[model samples]
Target: MKNFDTDVAVVGAGLIGSATALALRQRGVAVVMLERDLGGSRASGVNFGGVRRQGRSPAQLHLAARAHPIWADLKAKIGIDGEYVRSGHIKLARSQADLTALAAYAARVADFDLGLEILEGRAFRERYPCFGPEIIGGSFCPGDGQANPRLVAAAYAQAARQAGCEVIERCPVTGITREGDGFLLRCGDAVAVRARRLVNAAGAWGAGIAAALGDDIPMRFDYPTILVTEPLPPIVSVNIGIEGGGFYGRQVERGNLVMGGGFGVASGDGASRPDSGALARIGGRAAAILPATRHARVIRIWAGIEGYTADKNPFIGESANVPGLFHAFGFSGGGFQIAPAVGEVLCELICEGRSSTPVEAFRPDRFQQQSAEPGRTP
Candidate 1:
């Protein structure tokens, strides 16, 4: 059996894992990243790439606020463009009720210094005429934007590699065993990895990893479908989303509009593809938001499996049942934007034995209290 040793063993080379590995290596921690497929081939590489804090849950605002600066300087730190653009993010409201919700949300996050601008009626139309007449008002966050999901995870993994981190692609961890204050990770029956610390950044497969270590987190897999239209003249300047999550879309520099809504189907083993019927519904909604999209030819449509926790918040920080093991997963669909900050947080937890950010609400054992109840697992 082939054996290797490292200070940290990170499973799943998605954005979170790659970012964590990169951060750990930068701190001089010997790190090894194991990927089931090519790094970032899953949800991390195939997400909507909205790097916004406007529509996040209250629990996520703190992390999102901390992540914003990191994202702003991502290109400089990663040595790649990653197509990150701070073109701003606008969430439209179709009715007075939706507008009220936006106002309440803006008020709630005011203390966080988000500076959300609320626009209505003539002001909204004059600033953003790309929308259909149905849009009544909107909330805009100038600092929030979008990035290229296809480029980010792989870029972090490559950067980690250049910084002396070992990244093992196509290596699926089949079993894990405790070994003298460390972990013995078995990939198939041949390769073995012994590490003093472990990070479960497995995205949709994270629940299983947590369960293996005796922490049964309630996580569900969701397959969100995304559609890309052929390049058109730039019309939508800001990343757009409708209140209530009816639809969301953004135009890249290449002029193609990437949009997504609704869920698709996935196989038992987690292989997923876009649902034609769902894609049709998404296309109709996209055209409704921007009529020009009705004429734009769709060039690609795909789906990826992402984990969603019961409360729609991620599980971060160390495990309660196991020592020297940490978890960061179940961002629902928002992990891509805050992944870099999460990596930094993980590094702090591992290296300094605590995080500077207030991550108490994201503890891995939060679900344990809910799971203790009979016939229900939150």
Candidate 2:
């Protein structure tokens, strides 16, 4: 067995894991990244790639805003051309109920001066001519945007390597055991390795890692299905999301529409791959907002096992019981957009035990009451 050494071990080379490793490396922490598969091929790649602020829970919105610049910085530094479309986003409201909710959100965000506005029927038509005439009113956030999720992950992985991070692919971690101030991580094919700090960035499979370390947070696998349409003209001007969050999407640089938002059909294990029937069910919902897509031919469909916590928020902090272990998953389909910022802040927390953003809201220990009894396994 080959021995490995690093300041931190990040399990899972998807967006969260790679981004966290890159963030740690940026902060001068020697990081080693392990991935079960090639990087950026699943959740990181399957997502719709909307770098958005709309419909995000308040805490997540703040993180999204902060992460925006990090995305820009990444694009510039990596030169991967993540197909960023900062053309802004519009959450369309087809029914009066949807309009009312948009209004409430606009009022709620007024204090932040995020420049959110309600575009009435005529105004909405003027701004977005492609939207069906049935559109009532909508909310628009100028700063919200979109990017290629795959490219973003790839950029970070390459950048992390260039910055001296050791990335080991096909190194699926079989187990993680707590030692004195670190962990003995068991991976396939390779011998166990030790690290001073361990990061649980293993989306979907993160909860298992936490359980192994005698820590438990409410995290489960949720399948969010997605599909890409045949390439066409730039039909969508802005990132679009319909009511209730089941259908959301953006137009890619290839001019094909990428659609996803939860409630997708089961693909591979349903537990692992995106579903097709679910994607079709959601496509019907997507067509509800954009009636023009009714006849659009869907070229492909896919599924991704996203991390879903009991409360729908991510578990993004240190374990109350484990001193050197940290968690940054349970994003519930929202990881792609804010991954960079999440990584940056997580690096600070793991290396220095503090972050610029007050992450009290995302603390995993908050669910301690939900964990099993004192004698029970976490």
Candidate 3:
């Protein structure tokens, strides 16, 4: 066996794993990342890339807040543009109920240091004439923005390589076994990795890894369908979403309008394909929100699988049953925004046994009534 040794072995070289490897290497730890395919070919590469904190749940607000600065400085840190633009994010309220919910959320997050502007009626129309008349009100966060998901994970992997981290692509981890003081991972019978610590950043396929280590997290797969319209005049300057998340969209600098909503079809191997019905619904909703999009022709459509936990919050922290095993998955379609921060936090957990950021609520055993007993072998 071609055996390699490292202080940490990260499975799944998506944004979280690549970022974790980069952080660990920067901290002088030996890190090796293994991926099933080319890095970021899954959810991380295909996400909508809305780097916003305005609509996050209370438990994820802190992580999102901490991640905002990272996105702003990503080009400087990773040496890649990733097309990051802080064009602001606006969530439209289509009804009185939606407006009330936006107001309540704005009040709830007021102390969180996010400067939110509540626009309604005349203010909404005057500020954003591009939106349709159906939008009664909206909440805007000037700092929230968008980025290019297709480039982020690969950039992180490059930065990790530059920091002396070993990244192995197209090496699927077939089996994992606890060996002495560490773990032995078999990668498709060609390579073996022994590491004192393991970080499972396996996006939608995370539950299988957790189950192998005696932790059964209730994770479901969601395939969000996305469609892009043909190039048009630059009408949208900010990322747009609905209050209840029925639809979300943004226009690229090249004038293509990208939008996604609803679920798609998932294959047996966890891969996903765009659903025609879902794409149609998203286009209809997009037109309703912005009349200018009513006649835009859809140029392309796609979908990818994302892991969603029962509570819609990610499971980030050490394993309850297994020693030296960590997890950072189940972001429920919101991982793109906070992936870098998650990597930093995971590095803290692996190196120091604790993270400075508050991750208590995202523990792997939170869904269980009692923690699983240790000593279970993979």
Candidate 4:
């Protein structure tokens, strides 16, 4: 029954939502952060939390390199322990094709001067003895790192709250209606939150929120599960053992290995349960790359759904047809690293009506125009 009239209303209090709220508040904007449940209770709490730049497309790598510093800045500004470890990232090569891919990716980033090295064969083994005999070379990005995703979400929510933003927990937005140069968010059971502008940060359920506002966002949600192994002696320096779409994991500060890949057991729609079989299969690959993992028991497994757009980018900025409606979804799996920059960009768009960063790469209209009339030119 809380009636809120603010400068901005942000739906979904995950990393992006919370960060956007914090940014807007920093600029003296009145922000209301609405969470269906609580912040970080979903994917924000469940992701691998790897703030990495390696293995990213050229565009993403450039943005991540910039976003890395913003994370540190946020950590320092908020005094929140998001576990901002600036550990280097490594992508191991189990096959020749993997080696080639790493080499090509290295060449691509040469312009950014990312300080990476291509280690191969015996040299790679000499650098990392923990891997199995079948191991090959690897590409290492010294600047990449990892952070606790849950901690980031918490810090943003707290900072936003401290900066005069209203954070509403357990409020699911039932619908959105447009007002003059603003919008009103309909919570269930006659509850409503109003604001001059509205941001859609619903993550996996973001597309539904868009539709609720009579705007159809072309995106889907896919849930993936990952598991962690019991702490073992530090066998690998950084995360290792990945190929094709298959992935490996990095060892965390707690000494446990957090692992996941593009490959996993297919759970039904909106599934959030962890699947041991998927972990077992991924663990088999981990053992194949580094035999030592076989001895480590899997302690826990978890799952969270992430948004995927028709294009491989995100959907930031105001919706094309819906005035005062903003969306920050469609990050695919690369949201963790670029989230800070995404927040910064979104904050600029919300405050100044545009961002310095080239948001054209992540525009919501990108998907809509893909199937438009041939000469309609986006």
Candidate 5:
């Protein structure tokens, strides 16, 4: 039997788990991270790589702000740049109503010091002439940007390993249960891991882990479709998103355009792929927004499995019923930008008994309280 022991066992080797492992090791804690599949093969690698503070819920702004510096120093942390750019993010407004809504959102988040610039009419066209005339205006957050999802998680995993954290790939924990004063993770009789604490960072399978621990959080799966086009002269300058949330895209320095929106297909075994119908819809919207993409050939299309909660927020604290068991999943598709800060928060919670960052809104018991209320469904 392959038996191992550690101070903390982290399930999932995605960016969040890997970063947490690295952070723990930096603080002189023993960490062993387990992944069912290759690290970053899921949502962490397949996401559109939007590292932005724009178009996020107010509750997430603090976390996003906290993660900005981490992205700034990512190369020093992981030894690779990860193709991250602070190229700014613009949320397009197709109509006057959309512009008004964007303005209102900017006003609501003004206290966060995001420095959102609202451009409309002649000023908007002059600022972003590449967009179609239909896009009346947009709200630009200069601090927001994009990164290469494919390279980030693996880099962090390697960095964690270098820092003395045991990262085991393809070691799926089939079941987890309390053993004495610690937790026992069983890998289908092939391996067993014992740890004083556990971190549920599994991307799509996180709900099952929480359920096993009696958290029973309400979460559903999503397959977000992303497509990339053949290399061409760069036309779009920054990451783009629609105000109403139908489409979003960005162009890499190599001149390939990455666009994503709409749900795709997910299999029973957790595999996912881009749906043809969704791709067609995205194509029509892309052509409408950016005429330059009308003739660009799409070279690849893919989708990743993500767990989303009803309120569209994530659970990022210790479990309500299970002590020493931390929950950090259910990001509802916006986890990438805030993942670094989340790793720091998880480390603080594990090593120091609490996180200095404000995470009261992400308490694991929030949904449980809602479920307990009359006429409320989790």
Candidate 6:
């Protein structure tokens, strides 16, 4: 058996974890990153890859804004463009109620300087003629866009490795415990890691680490599916999303349209399959939202496991129970866009004992407090 000692041990190698390691290494910190599978091979690689700040809840906008510049400088940081583009993101409203909600959201986030434009009637149709008749109006964030998710996470991991972070793949941690003022991570009998601090970024499996630390986090697993259509003539340049959460899609430069909505079925043993019914529903909705894609042949369908907290907001702070433990998981399915900033924030907390970014809203122990409140279920 081999033993490794480090200043910090990161428990996952997804975009968030890899980014954290990269940032920590840049600051001359001794860090070790462990992953069960190849880095970025899980939810981080299979997501829709929308590098968007639109359609996010108000509380999440700040973090999304923080990540925007990182995406802009992605190539310089990770050494690959990752097929990222600022194709804009439009949230369509099919009904008056949806339009009202979208308008409210746009107004609420105006202070964030998103420069959102709400268009309807001829103005909306003239700009985006590919949208179907059902799309009454839309709020557009002109700077938002999409990227290739499969390439991003892995690129971050590679950059972290090059920057002197010890990345161990296919080494799943079986358990974690507090020893003295540090943490001891056991990866079966082959390897053991000891670190002064621990970061839980294991996506859907992060709850297990929290549990081992005596925290009963109310986290659940979700299998969200994405469908890709065979290359067709480019129809939509901007990424599209529904106001009330029905469908979301974007066309890549190669002419393939990527669409996703709803959840899939978990196929036991930590695997999941795309739900056919949900895919069909997504197709119907896409046909109504983007008529040009109605006949586009679907070439692939896949799903990835993600962790969602009760309120859908992620846990992103030091543990209330364990002083040396930090968490950056349970982002529902909207984490890709904000992951870089999260890594920076985590680095701030670890090295400086605080962060300038507003992370109080993502307390890891908020659910515990919620469950203790009257009639509240976390």
Q: lDDT per model, in order?
A: 0.88, 0.77, 0.88, 0.77, 0.88, 0.90
Tens digit of per-residue lDDT, candidate 1, span 26-82? 899999889989988999999999998888877788789888998888877688878
Worst 10 residues of 4 by lDDT: 369-378
Instruction: Please report how far candidate 2 places residue 281 from its true position, in Å.
Output: 2.5
What digit string (tens of lDDT, one per residue) describes model 2 on residues 284-329? Answer: 7667666667788898876677777666678898888988888888
Candidate 2: pairs in clash: 264-278, 265-275, 265-278, 265-279, 266-275, 267-274, 267-275, 274-303
What's the TM for model 5? Answer: 0.97
What tens digits encode model 6's per-residue C-alpha lDDT throughout 1-378?
Answer: 779999999999999999999999999999999999999999999999888898787788889989998898899999998999999999999888988998898888888999999999999989989988888989999999889989998999999999999999999999888999999999999789999999999988888888899987778788888999999897999998888786899999999999998778888877888998999999999888888888889999998899887777899989988998999999989999999999999999999999888889899988785552121111
Candidate achieving higher TM-score, 3 or 4: 3
TM-score per candidate, chains pooled:
0.96, 0.92, 0.96, 0.92, 0.97, 0.97
- Runs of candidate 1 with Cα error greater than 4 angstroms are 371-378
Candidates 3 and 6 compared: the better one by lDDT is: 6
Tens-digit per-residue lDDT, 263-307, candidate 5: 888655668778899999998899989988999999999888888
For model 3, the local distance difference test gives: 0.88
lDDT by residue for model 4 (298-331), tens: 8887777877776567788798888788999878
Off by over 4 Å in 4: 262-271, 369-378
lDDT: which candidate is best?
Answer: 6
lDDT of candidate 1 at residue 212, scale 0 to 100: 85
- The CA lDDT at 61 in model 2 is 72
